[model samples]
Target: MLTLFHSPGACSMGIVFLLEELGVDYTLAAIDLRKGEQNDTAFRQMNPKGKVPTLILDDGTALTEFPAIAYWLCRRHGAAELWPDTIDGQARVLELVEFLVASIHMRGFTFLAMPQKFSADPAAQDSLRALGRREVEAGLATVAAQHGAALCARSRIGIEDAALFYILVWARALGIAVPAPLSAYAEALLARPSAQVALRGLAAG
Candidate 1:
């Protein structure tokens, strides 16, 4: 059985939603980020990156990273609706995924959430946070311009939107305003049975 290491309300929640949508059997292992369970020796043994959303396959093979996990699940389960079929559509999915995970989550949100990683100086930290806010808003605007209308009010949830959902959660936490289109998208996503199950988390087996 697949085992997913995740923290509630974190980026790993996206993977949780994907797993639910796939309707595949999987186990959930909670990692307390606040308590630093990610850095624990046992968890680190499986994933040296010490991050959430680390998927442990049946054979004990560890898969780390969001995009990789999402792709693997969709392919393994024949979830074409979540992934896409055509070359252009696949390319668009990847483009949005990379932008959302790498740019929005890694760079922008990290900056705002953990500015001390960039610099120890208090003055520099302030500037870093400000830069983070700008980066996130600008990145979100790019998303809104490119695909917001298509995704907003959409009944079918794509892989890209799963990625976008987590970012929207962070945006809300940071008190950042998201585009109207994306806001509607978030509502639709959250209302789904998959999302509802994901939010409450799955039972460990």
Candidate 2:
């Protein structure tokens, strides 16, 4: 069985949705970030970075980071519907994934939610967060411009959409305002059955 260590409403929510969409058997382990369970010694051993969404494979190997876990699940279960097929399709998926991870996902969460790590000076931290917010907005705009419409019309969920959906959710939870297009995109994603299950689970937790 696969075990996913996740926090409510974190980017890990996307992983949860993906698992359900693929109809794969897995176990969900909630990490209470509010109580700093992510920083606990046992959790640190699972993810030294103290991040959520760590995947423990059936063989007891742990996987950190979203892109790897998402892709691995898609491949392992032969769920090609959640992943692209051709070379160009795969490249586009990766391009979107990297942009979200670098500009919006990591940068957004770090500067906004954990500013103390970047700087001790209050003014400096605010300045960095302001810049990070702008970058996140720009990154979302770029994603919407490039692929939003195509994804909305697609018949099935794919890795790019899953990644983008979770990033938007995390942004909202951190009180980062997203533009209208991205908000619409998120609404569409959340309306899916798999996402509904993930949302209910998050709410219940």
Best by lDDT: 1
In model 2, pairs of residues that clash are none
TM-score of each: 0.91, 0.88
Which tens-of-lDDT digit does each residue in 138-166 have in candidate 2? 77778778777776667777766568768
For each candidate, the alpha-carbon lDDT, in order, equals 0.84, 0.79
Per-residue lDDT of candidate 1, residues 1-205 (tens digit):
9999999878999998888877889999999888999999999999999999999998999999899988888788745566677999899889999999999988898898889978999999999898889999999998988888888645666677668878987787677888878777766777788877777743432
The lDDT of model 1 is 0.84
Candidate 2 steric clashes: 0
How well does candidate 1 match the true structure in TM-score terms?
Answer: 0.91
Candidate 1 wrong stretches, greater than 4 Å: 201-205
Enumerate residue pairs that collide in model 1: none
Worst 10 residues of 1 by lDDT: 196-205
Worst 10 residues of 2 by lDDT: 196-205
